[model samples]
Target: MEDRKLTVRAVERALDILLCFTRGSELGLTEIASQIGLHKSTVHRLLTTLEEKGFLIRNPSTEKYRLGIRIWELSTHLPVFDESATLLLPAMERLRDRLGETVSLYLRDGFERVRIQAVQSEQAIRRVAQIGARLPLSVGASSKVLAAYAPPEVLRELLESAGWPDYVERSAYRQQLEDIIRIGYATSFEEREPGAAAVAVPVTGRSGNVVAALSLSGPVSRLSRETLVEYAAVLRETAEEMGLMLP
Candidate 1:
Protein backbone atom coordinates (compact mmCIF):
# COMPACT_ATOMS: atom_id res chain seq x y z
CA MET A 1 0.00 0.00 0.00
CA GLU A 2 2.82 2.43 0.79
CA ASP A 3 4.57 1.65 -2.49
CA ARG A 4 1.37 2.18 -4.46
CA LYS A 5 0.77 5.54 -2.72
CA LEU A 6 4.31 6.69 -3.47
CA THR A 7 3.97 5.66 -7.13
CA VAL A 8 0.69 7.55 -7.47
CA ARG A 9 2.14 10.66 -5.88
CA ALA A 10 5.13 10.59 -8.19
CA VAL A 11 2.90 10.25 -11.20
CA GLU A 12 0.78 13.17 -10.03
CA ARG A 13 3.82 15.38 -9.58
CA ALA A 14 5.17 14.43 -12.99
CA LEU A 15 1.84 15.27 -14.62
CA ASP A 16 1.71 18.59 -12.81
CA ILE A 17 5.14 19.50 -14.11
CA LEU A 18 4.08 18.61 -17.65
CA LEU A 19 0.87 20.59 -17.42
CA CYS A 20 2.75 23.71 -16.39
CA PHE A 21 4.21 24.01 -19.91
CA THR A 22 0.80 23.89 -21.62
CA ARG A 23 0.02 27.60 -21.28
CA GLY A 24 3.42 28.47 -22.74
CA SER A 25 5.94 26.71 -24.98
CA GLU A 26 8.60 26.27 -22.33
CA LEU A 27 9.06 26.81 -18.57
CA GLY A 28 11.88 26.91 -16.03
CA LEU A 29 12.10 24.73 -12.91
CA THR A 30 11.27 27.62 -10.56
CA GLU A 31 8.21 28.58 -12.60
CA ILE A 32 6.92 25.02 -12.62
CA ALA A 33 7.55 24.61 -8.89
CA SER A 34 5.79 27.90 -8.13
CA GLN A 35 2.83 27.05 -10.37
CA ILE A 36 2.35 23.54 -8.94
CA GLY A 37 3.11 24.45 -5.32
CA LEU A 38 6.06 22.08 -5.14
CA HIS A 39 9.54 22.77 -3.86
CA LYS A 40 12.16 23.77 -6.39
CA SER A 41 14.26 20.71 -5.58
CA THR A 42 11.32 18.36 -6.04
CA VAL A 43 10.40 19.99 -9.35
CA HIS A 44 14.00 19.73 -10.52
CA ARG A 45 14.14 16.01 -9.75
CA LEU A 46 10.82 15.38 -11.52
CA LEU A 47 11.87 17.41 -14.54
CA THR A 48 15.15 15.52 -14.76
CA THR A 49 13.30 12.20 -14.67
CA LEU A 50 10.81 13.31 -17.30
CA GLU A 51 13.54 14.68 -19.56
CA GLU A 52 15.50 11.44 -19.31
CA LYS A 53 12.37 9.47 -20.22
CA GLY A 54 11.93 11.57 -23.43
CA PHE A 55 8.63 13.12 -22.24
CA LEU A 56 10.33 16.51 -21.92
CA ILE A 57 13.39 18.24 -23.31
CA ARG A 58 15.58 21.08 -22.11
CA ASN A 59 16.59 23.73 -24.61
CA PRO A 60 20.34 24.24 -24.43
CA SER A 61 20.05 27.93 -25.35
CA THR A 62 17.09 28.87 -23.16
CA GLU A 63 17.76 26.35 -20.35
CA LYS A 64 14.00 25.80 -20.11
CA TYR A 65 11.89 22.67 -20.55
CA ARG A 66 9.40 22.00 -23.34
CA LEU A 67 7.38 19.03 -24.46
CA GLY A 68 9.42 16.49 -26.45
CA ILE A 69 8.78 14.63 -29.71
CA ARG A 70 7.96 11.50 -27.71
CA ILE A 71 4.60 13.01 -26.90
CA TRP A 72 3.74 13.28 -30.60
CA GLU A 73 5.08 9.80 -31.31
CA LEU A 74 2.96 8.30 -28.53
CA SER A 75 -0.10 10.27 -29.57
CA THR A 76 0.15 8.94 -33.13
CA HIS A 77 -0.33 5.43 -31.76
CA LEU A 78 -3.59 6.33 -30.00
CA PRO A 79 -6.72 4.79 -31.46
CA VAL A 80 -8.55 7.78 -32.91
CA PHE A 81 -11.54 5.96 -34.36
CA ASP A 82 -12.49 3.26 -31.81
CA GLU A 83 -14.59 1.11 -34.18
CA SER A 84 -16.23 4.20 -35.61
CA ALA A 85 -14.19 3.89 -38.80
CA THR A 86 -15.24 0.28 -39.20
CA LEU A 87 -18.85 1.43 -39.23
CA LEU A 88 -18.14 4.18 -41.75
CA LEU A 89 -15.76 2.34 -44.12
CA PRO A 90 -18.53 1.01 -46.31
CA ALA A 91 -20.08 4.47 -46.60
CA MET A 92 -16.71 5.92 -47.49
CA GLU A 93 -16.25 3.25 -50.15
CA ARG A 94 -19.67 4.02 -51.57
CA LEU A 95 -18.93 7.71 -51.65
CA ARG A 96 -15.65 7.02 -53.40
CA ASP A 97 -17.40 4.90 -55.93
CA ARG A 98 -20.10 7.50 -56.49
CA LEU A 99 -17.72 10.39 -56.90
CA GLY A 100 -14.99 8.30 -58.55
CA GLU A 101 -12.53 10.09 -56.30
CA THR A 102 -10.43 9.30 -53.28
CA VAL A 103 -12.40 9.37 -50.03
CA SER A 104 -10.69 9.82 -46.68
CA LEU A 105 -11.62 10.09 -43.02
CA TYR A 106 -9.58 12.44 -40.87
CA LEU A 107 -9.56 12.89 -37.09
CA ARG A 108 -8.05 15.77 -35.13
CA ASP A 109 -4.92 14.89 -33.15
CA GLY A 110 -4.09 17.80 -30.88
CA PHE A 111 -3.46 20.74 -33.26
CA GLU A 112 -3.03 18.47 -36.30
CA ARG A 113 -5.27 16.20 -38.35
CA VAL A 114 -4.48 12.58 -39.11
CA ARG A 115 -5.85 10.51 -41.95
CA ILE A 116 -7.30 7.46 -40.27
CA GLN A 117 -8.92 5.73 -43.24
CA ALA A 118 -9.02 6.07 -46.98
CA VAL A 119 -10.76 4.61 -50.01
CA GLN A 120 -8.43 5.26 -52.88
CA SER A 121 -9.61 6.04 -56.40
CA GLU A 122 -9.10 3.26 -58.93
CA GLN A 123 -8.11 5.62 -61.71
CA ALA A 124 -4.47 5.90 -62.65
CA ILE A 125 -4.58 9.70 -62.54
CA ARG A 126 -5.99 10.13 -59.05
CA ARG A 127 -4.86 11.95 -55.95
CA VAL A 128 -3.91 9.50 -53.22
CA ALA A 129 -3.75 10.05 -49.49
CA GLN A 130 -1.89 7.53 -47.40
CA ILE A 131 -3.50 6.32 -44.21
CA GLY A 132 -1.92 7.40 -40.90
CA ALA A 133 -0.56 10.57 -42.47
CA ARG A 134 -0.56 13.66 -40.23
CA LEU A 135 -1.31 17.10 -41.67
CA PRO A 136 -1.49 20.63 -40.33
CA LEU A 137 -5.00 21.75 -39.31
CA SER A 138 -4.61 25.07 -41.12
CA VAL A 139 -4.73 23.65 -44.66
CA GLY A 140 -6.59 21.02 -46.75
CA ALA A 141 -10.33 20.46 -46.95
CA SER A 142 -10.38 17.64 -44.42
CA SER A 143 -8.42 19.66 -41.89
CA LYS A 144 -10.50 22.76 -42.48
CA VAL A 145 -13.77 20.91 -41.95
CA LEU A 146 -12.50 19.54 -38.65
CA ALA A 147 -11.17 22.97 -37.64
CA ALA A 148 -14.37 24.76 -38.59
CA TYR A 149 -16.40 22.78 -36.08
CA ALA A 150 -13.76 22.67 -33.35
CA PRO A 151 -14.60 24.19 -29.94
CA PRO A 152 -13.90 27.90 -29.58
CA GLU A 153 -10.81 27.42 -27.44
CA VAL A 154 -9.34 24.82 -29.79
CA LEU A 155 -10.15 26.94 -32.84
CA ARG A 156 -8.46 29.95 -31.32
CA GLU A 157 -5.36 27.95 -30.47
CA LEU A 158 -5.11 26.57 -34.02
CA LEU A 159 -5.50 30.01 -35.59
CA GLU A 160 -2.90 31.54 -33.31
CA SER A 161 -0.36 28.85 -34.11
CA ALA A 162 -1.22 28.36 -37.75
CA GLY A 163 1.01 30.21 -40.27
CA TRP A 164 -1.71 31.17 -42.67
CA PRO A 165 -1.12 32.25 -46.25
CA ASP A 166 -0.35 35.91 -46.79
CA TYR A 167 -3.27 36.14 -49.21
CA VAL A 168 -5.58 34.95 -46.44
CA GLU A 169 -6.15 37.79 -44.02
CA ARG A 170 -6.76 36.69 -40.41
CA SER A 171 -10.16 38.37 -40.23
CA ALA A 172 -11.16 37.04 -43.64
CA TYR A 173 -9.96 33.54 -42.72
CA ARG A 174 -11.97 33.70 -39.52
CA GLN A 175 -15.03 34.68 -41.53
CA GLN A 176 -14.39 31.80 -43.93
CA LEU A 177 -14.23 29.37 -41.02
CA GLU A 178 -17.55 30.68 -39.77
CA ASP A 179 -19.01 30.24 -43.25
CA ILE A 180 -17.78 26.67 -43.40
CA ILE A 181 -19.55 25.90 -40.12
CA ARG A 182 -22.71 27.55 -41.34
CA ILE A 183 -22.62 25.77 -44.71
CA GLY A 184 -21.76 22.34 -43.23
CA TYR A 185 -18.80 21.73 -45.57
CA ALA A 186 -15.38 23.02 -46.69
CA THR A 187 -13.49 23.09 -49.99
CA SER A 188 -9.83 23.38 -50.98
CA PHE A 189 -8.35 23.99 -54.43
CA GLU A 190 -4.67 23.13 -54.60
CA GLU A 191 -4.35 24.62 -51.14
CA ARG A 192 -2.14 22.02 -49.47
CA GLU A 193 -0.64 20.42 -52.56
CA PRO A 194 -0.50 21.51 -56.15
CA GLY A 195 -2.86 19.86 -58.66
CA ALA A 196 -5.16 18.57 -55.91
CA ALA A 197 -8.69 19.60 -54.96
CA ALA A 198 -10.89 18.38 -52.12
CA VAL A 199 -14.27 18.90 -50.42
CA ALA A 200 -15.06 17.81 -46.90
CA VAL A 201 -17.83 17.70 -44.30
CA PRO A 202 -17.73 17.25 -40.54
CA VAL A 203 -18.82 14.04 -38.80
CA THR A 204 -20.52 14.69 -35.48
CA GLY A 205 -20.63 12.37 -32.52
CA ARG A 206 -23.58 11.49 -30.30
CA SER A 207 -22.95 14.70 -28.35
CA GLY A 208 -23.25 16.76 -31.59
CA ASN A 209 -19.57 17.68 -31.37
CA VAL A 210 -17.52 17.29 -34.54
CA VAL A 211 -15.38 14.18 -34.26
CA ALA A 212 -13.98 13.72 -37.75
CA ALA A 213 -14.01 14.90 -41.35
CA LEU A 214 -15.22 13.01 -44.42
CA SER A 215 -13.44 14.20 -47.54
CA LEU A 216 -13.36 13.48 -51.28
CA SER A 217 -10.21 14.40 -53.15
CA GLY A 218 -8.97 14.16 -56.71
CA PRO A 219 -6.72 15.81 -59.26
CA VAL A 220 -7.67 19.42 -59.89
CA SER A 221 -8.04 18.73 -63.61
CA ARG A 222 -10.77 16.23 -62.77
CA LEU A 223 -12.31 17.83 -59.67
CA SER A 224 -13.04 21.37 -60.84
CA ARG A 225 -14.94 24.04 -58.97
CA GLU A 226 -18.36 22.83 -60.12
CA THR A 227 -17.49 19.22 -59.39
CA LEU A 228 -16.29 20.07 -55.87
CA VAL A 229 -19.58 21.78 -55.02
CA GLU A 230 -21.54 18.83 -56.33
CA TYR A 231 -19.48 16.33 -54.37
CA ALA A 232 -19.74 18.50 -51.25
CA ALA A 233 -23.43 17.59 -51.09
CA VAL A 234 -22.59 13.90 -51.17
CA LEU A 235 -19.89 14.33 -48.54
CA ARG A 236 -22.29 16.14 -46.21
CA GLU A 237 -24.95 13.45 -46.57
CA THR A 238 -22.45 10.69 -45.89
CA ALA A 239 -21.04 12.54 -42.90
CA GLU A 240 -24.55 12.96 -41.45
CA GLU A 241 -25.20 9.24 -41.90
CA MET A 242 -21.94 8.36 -40.14
CA GLY A 243 -22.65 10.83 -37.34
CA LEU A 244 -25.92 9.05 -36.56
CA MET A 245 -24.09 5.73 -36.32
CA LEU A 246 -21.07 6.90 -34.24
CA PRO A 247 -21.15 6.17 -30.54
Candidate 2:
Protein backbone atom coordinates (compact mmCIF):
# COMPACT_ATOMS: atom_id res chain seq x y z
CA MET A 1 0.00 0.00 0.00
CA GLU A 2 2.80 2.43 0.83
CA ASP A 3 4.58 1.63 -2.43
CA ARG A 4 1.38 2.23 -4.42
CA LYS A 5 0.95 5.60 -2.77
CA LEU A 6 4.52 6.52 -3.64
CA THR A 7 3.91 5.54 -7.26
CA VAL A 8 0.76 7.65 -7.40
CA ARG A 9 2.59 10.65 -5.96
CA ALA A 10 5.38 10.24 -8.48
CA VAL A 11 2.88 10.13 -11.36
CA GLU A 12 1.14 13.23 -10.06
CA ARG A 13 4.43 15.08 -9.81
CA ALA A 14 5.34 14.07 -13.36
CA LEU A 15 2.00 15.36 -14.61
CA ASP A 16 2.43 18.59 -12.74
CA ILE A 17 5.81 19.08 -14.33
CA LEU A 18 4.41 18.43 -17.76
CA LEU A 19 1.60 20.93 -17.14
CA CYS A 20 4.14 23.64 -16.36
CA PHE A 21 4.89 24.21 -20.02
CA THR A 22 2.53 26.77 -21.52
CA ARG A 23 2.17 27.07 -25.27
CA GLY A 24 5.50 28.01 -26.85
CA SER A 25 7.12 28.12 -23.38
CA GLU A 26 10.58 26.60 -23.00
CA LEU A 27 12.35 26.33 -19.68
CA GLY A 28 15.65 25.33 -18.19
CA LEU A 29 15.93 22.94 -15.24
CA THR A 30 15.89 25.73 -12.64
CA GLU A 31 12.88 27.43 -14.24
CA ILE A 32 10.83 24.22 -14.25
CA ALA A 33 11.78 23.56 -10.64
CA SER A 34 10.71 27.08 -9.71
CA GLN A 35 7.42 26.90 -11.60
CA ILE A 36 6.50 23.55 -10.05
CA GLY A 37 7.71 24.62 -6.64
CA LEU A 38 9.98 21.57 -6.37
CA HIS A 39 13.65 21.28 -5.48
CA LYS A 40 16.10 21.43 -8.39
CA SER A 41 17.54 17.98 -7.69
CA THR A 42 14.12 16.26 -7.85
CA VAL A 43 13.04 18.31 -10.85
CA HIS A 44 16.22 17.67 -12.79
CA ARG A 45 15.82 13.91 -12.35
CA LEU A 46 12.26 14.04 -13.64
CA LEU A 47 13.34 16.28 -16.54
CA THR A 48 16.07 13.89 -17.51
CA THR A 49 13.63 10.97 -17.53
CA LEU A 50 11.15 12.94 -19.61
CA GLU A 51 13.82 13.91 -22.16
CA GLU A 52 14.96 10.33 -22.45
CA LYS A 53 11.39 9.18 -23.12
CA GLY A 54 10.89 11.85 -25.83
CA PHE A 55 8.26 13.65 -23.79
CA LEU A 56 10.65 16.60 -23.60
CA ILE A 57 13.44 17.69 -25.90
CA ARG A 58 16.57 19.54 -24.80
CA ASN A 59 18.35 22.13 -26.91
CA PRO A 60 22.10 21.36 -26.86
CA SER A 61 23.17 24.96 -27.44
CA THR A 62 20.50 26.67 -25.27
CA GLU A 63 20.48 23.87 -22.63
CA LYS A 64 16.71 24.48 -22.38
CA TYR A 65 13.90 21.94 -22.49
CA ARG A 66 10.74 22.16 -24.66
CA LEU A 67 7.67 19.98 -24.98
CA GLY A 68 8.51 17.27 -27.52
CA ILE A 69 6.87 15.55 -30.51
CA ARG A 70 5.74 12.71 -28.25
CA ILE A 71 3.07 15.00 -26.84
CA TRP A 72 1.69 15.59 -30.34
CA GLU A 73 1.67 11.84 -31.01
CA LEU A 74 -0.47 11.25 -27.93
CA SER A 75 -2.68 14.23 -28.81
CA THR A 76 -3.71 12.51 -32.05
CA HIS A 77 -6.14 10.30 -30.12
CA LEU A 78 -8.14 13.23 -28.73
CA PRO A 79 -10.53 13.58 -31.71
CA VAL A 80 -10.92 9.87 -32.44
CA PHE A 81 -14.38 8.29 -32.54
CA ASP A 82 -15.35 6.76 -29.24
CA GLU A 83 -18.29 4.88 -30.78
CA SER A 84 -17.57 4.10 -34.39
CA ALA A 85 -21.13 2.89 -35.08
CA THR A 86 -22.64 6.28 -34.31
CA LEU A 87 -19.84 8.11 -36.11
CA LEU A 88 -19.96 5.89 -39.21
CA LEU A 89 -23.72 5.53 -39.54
CA PRO A 90 -24.14 8.36 -42.03
CA ALA A 91 -21.40 7.18 -44.35
CA MET A 92 -22.55 3.58 -44.18
CA GLU A 93 -26.13 4.58 -44.83
CA ARG A 94 -25.18 6.68 -47.83
CA LEU A 95 -23.40 3.73 -49.39
CA ARG A 96 -26.28 1.40 -48.66
CA ASP A 97 -28.70 3.74 -50.35
CA ARG A 98 -26.48 4.51 -53.31
CA LEU A 99 -25.31 0.98 -54.00
CA GLY A 100 -28.41 -0.85 -52.82
CA GLU A 101 -26.14 -3.26 -50.91
CA THR A 102 -24.82 -3.79 -47.46
CA VAL A 103 -22.15 -1.27 -46.46
CA SER A 104 -19.81 -2.28 -43.66
CA LEU A 105 -16.70 -0.95 -41.98
CA TYR A 106 -14.11 -3.53 -40.99
CA LEU A 107 -11.11 -2.77 -38.80
CA ARG A 108 -8.12 -5.06 -38.55
CA ASP A 109 -7.87 -7.08 -35.34
CA GLY A 110 -4.71 -9.16 -35.18
CA PHE A 111 -5.20 -11.80 -37.94
CA GLU A 112 -8.89 -11.01 -38.25
CA ARG A 113 -11.21 -8.35 -39.63
CA VAL A 114 -14.05 -7.33 -37.35
CA ARG A 115 -17.08 -5.51 -38.67
CA ILE A 116 -17.53 -2.50 -36.43
CA GLN A 117 -20.34 -0.75 -38.27
CA ALA A 118 -22.80 -1.66 -40.99
CA VAL A 119 -25.94 -0.58 -42.84
CA GLN A 120 -27.89 -3.42 -44.44
CA SER A 121 -29.35 -2.97 -47.89
CA GLU A 122 -33.07 -2.37 -47.98
CA GLN A 123 -33.44 -4.93 -50.76
CA ALA A 124 -35.43 -8.07 -49.96
CA ILE A 125 -32.42 -10.22 -50.76
CA ARG A 126 -29.22 -8.82 -49.31
CA ARG A 127 -26.05 -9.70 -47.47
CA VAL A 128 -26.49 -9.34 -43.72
CA ALA A 129 -23.33 -9.50 -41.62
CA GLN A 130 -24.04 -8.36 -38.08
CA ILE A 131 -21.88 -5.75 -36.43
CA GLY A 132 -18.91 -7.17 -34.50
CA ALA A 133 -18.72 -10.21 -36.74
CA ARG A 134 -15.13 -11.47 -36.83
CA LEU A 135 -13.76 -12.97 -40.04
CA PRO A 136 -10.35 -14.29 -40.97
CA LEU A 137 -7.89 -11.83 -42.52
CA SER A 138 -7.19 -14.32 -45.30
CA VAL A 139 -10.55 -14.10 -47.05
CA GLY A 140 -13.06 -11.56 -48.43
CA ALA A 141 -12.46 -8.22 -50.11
CA SER A 142 -12.66 -6.46 -46.75
CA SER A 143 -9.88 -8.52 -45.24
CA LYS A 144 -7.72 -8.51 -48.35
CA VAL A 145 -7.73 -4.71 -48.62
CA LEU A 146 -6.83 -4.48 -44.94
CA ALA A 147 -4.07 -7.08 -45.27
CA ALA A 148 -2.52 -5.21 -48.18
CA TYR A 149 -1.84 -2.16 -46.02
CA ALA A 150 -0.99 -3.85 -42.73
CA PRO A 151 2.61 -3.52 -41.53
CA PRO A 152 4.98 -6.08 -43.02
CA GLU A 153 5.44 -7.85 -39.69
CA VAL A 154 1.69 -8.04 -39.10
CA LEU A 155 1.03 -9.58 -42.50
CA ARG A 156 3.97 -11.89 -42.02
CA GLU A 157 2.67 -13.01 -38.64
CA LEU A 158 -0.79 -13.56 -40.14
CA LEU A 159 0.56 -15.70 -42.97
CA GLU A 160 2.77 -17.73 -40.69
CA SER A 161 0.00 -18.32 -38.16
CA ALA A 162 -2.91 -19.12 -40.52
CA GLY A 163 -1.79 -22.60 -41.79
CA TRP A 164 -3.37 -22.18 -45.20
CA PRO A 165 -4.34 -25.03 -47.53
CA ASP A 166 -2.27 -26.24 -50.49
CA TYR A 167 -4.65 -24.54 -52.93
CA VAL A 168 -3.65 -21.15 -51.46
CA GLU A 169 -0.04 -20.84 -52.63
CA ARG A 170 1.80 -18.32 -50.45
CA SER A 171 3.60 -16.69 -53.35
CA ALA A 172 0.41 -16.25 -55.39
CA TYR A 173 -1.52 -14.93 -52.37
CA ARG A 174 1.29 -12.47 -51.71
CA GLN A 175 1.06 -11.30 -55.31
CA GLN A 176 -2.69 -10.74 -54.92
CA LEU A 177 -2.03 -8.67 -51.80
CA GLU A 178 0.40 -6.63 -53.85
CA ASP A 179 -2.24 -6.05 -56.51
CA ILE A 180 -4.73 -4.80 -53.91
CA ILE A 181 -2.26 -2.17 -52.72
CA ARG A 182 -1.32 -1.23 -56.25
CA ILE A 183 -4.93 -0.87 -57.42
CA GLY A 184 -6.19 0.78 -54.23
CA TYR A 185 -9.14 -1.65 -54.01
CA ALA A 186 -10.11 -5.32 -53.87
CA THR A 187 -13.07 -7.43 -55.00
CA SER A 188 -14.24 -10.82 -53.81
CA PHE A 189 -16.52 -13.41 -55.41
CA GLU A 190 -17.52 -16.24 -53.10
CA GLU A 191 -14.33 -15.69 -51.15
CA ARG A 192 -15.66 -15.84 -47.62
CA GLU A 193 -19.01 -17.47 -48.30
CA PRO A 194 -20.64 -18.99 -51.36
CA GLY A 195 -22.96 -16.60 -53.22
CA ALA A 196 -21.52 -13.60 -51.33
CA ALA A 197 -19.64 -10.92 -53.22
CA ALA A 198 -18.12 -7.62 -52.12
CA VAL A 199 -15.83 -4.78 -53.14
CA ALA A 200 -13.68 -3.07 -50.54
CA VAL A 201 -11.38 -0.08 -50.34
CA PRO A 202 -9.05 1.10 -47.64
CA VAL A 203 -9.90 4.06 -45.42
CA THR A 204 -6.57 5.75 -44.84
CA GLY A 205 -5.92 8.00 -41.88
CA ARG A 206 -4.13 11.37 -42.04
CA SER A 207 -0.83 9.52 -41.84
CA GLY A 208 -1.67 7.59 -45.05
CA ASN A 209 -2.06 4.38 -43.09
CA VAL A 210 -5.04 2.09 -43.57
CA VAL A 211 -7.25 2.41 -40.51
CA ALA A 212 -10.32 0.51 -41.74
CA ALA A 213 -11.95 -1.02 -44.80
CA LEU A 214 -15.20 0.29 -46.26
CA SER A 215 -16.99 -2.40 -48.22
CA LEU A 216 -20.21 -3.08 -50.08
CA SER A 217 -21.55 -6.61 -50.13
CA GLY A 218 -24.50 -8.48 -51.60
CA PRO A 219 -25.54 -11.83 -53.05
CA VAL A 220 -23.77 -12.64 -56.31
CA SER A 221 -27.14 -12.86 -58.02
CA ARG A 222 -27.55 -9.12 -57.67
CA LEU A 223 -24.01 -7.79 -57.26
CA SER A 224 -22.12 -9.48 -60.06
CA ARG A 225 -18.41 -9.37 -60.83
CA GLU A 226 -19.17 -6.98 -63.70
CA THR A 227 -20.56 -4.26 -61.42
CA LEU A 228 -17.60 -4.32 -58.99
CA VAL A 229 -15.59 -1.83 -61.02
CA GLU A 230 -18.41 0.72 -60.91
CA TYR A 231 -19.17 0.07 -57.24
CA ALA A 232 -15.46 0.30 -56.44
CA ALA A 233 -15.35 3.75 -58.00
CA VAL A 234 -18.17 4.89 -55.73
CA LEU A 235 -16.60 3.24 -52.68
CA ARG A 236 -13.27 4.99 -53.34
CA GLU A 237 -14.92 8.40 -53.21
CA THR A 238 -17.00 7.58 -50.13
CA ALA A 239 -14.06 6.04 -48.30
CA GLU A 240 -11.85 9.05 -49.04
CA GLU A 241 -14.51 11.40 -47.74
CA MET A 242 -15.11 9.24 -44.69
CA GLY A 243 -11.36 9.11 -43.96
CA LEU A 244 -11.50 12.79 -43.03
CA MET A 245 -13.84 11.91 -40.16
CA LEU A 246 -11.18 9.73 -38.50
CA PRO A 247 -8.65 11.08 -36.05
Predicted model with the maximum TM-score: 1
lDDT of 1: 0.85
User: Runs in model 2 with CA error above 4 Å?
Assistant: 1-81
lDDT of 2 by residue, 1-247 (tens): 9999988988888888887774235888888888889999998888888989899999999989998989889966644346655787898888888889999998888888878888989999988877656777887899899889999999888788745555566787799899998888999999778999999999987777789999999999988888997899999999888888776
Candidate 1 Cα deviation (angstroms), residue 140: 1.2
Q: RMSD of each candidate?
A: 9.6, 16.3
| Candidate 2's TM-score | 0.66
209, model 1: CA deviation in Å?
Answer: 1.4
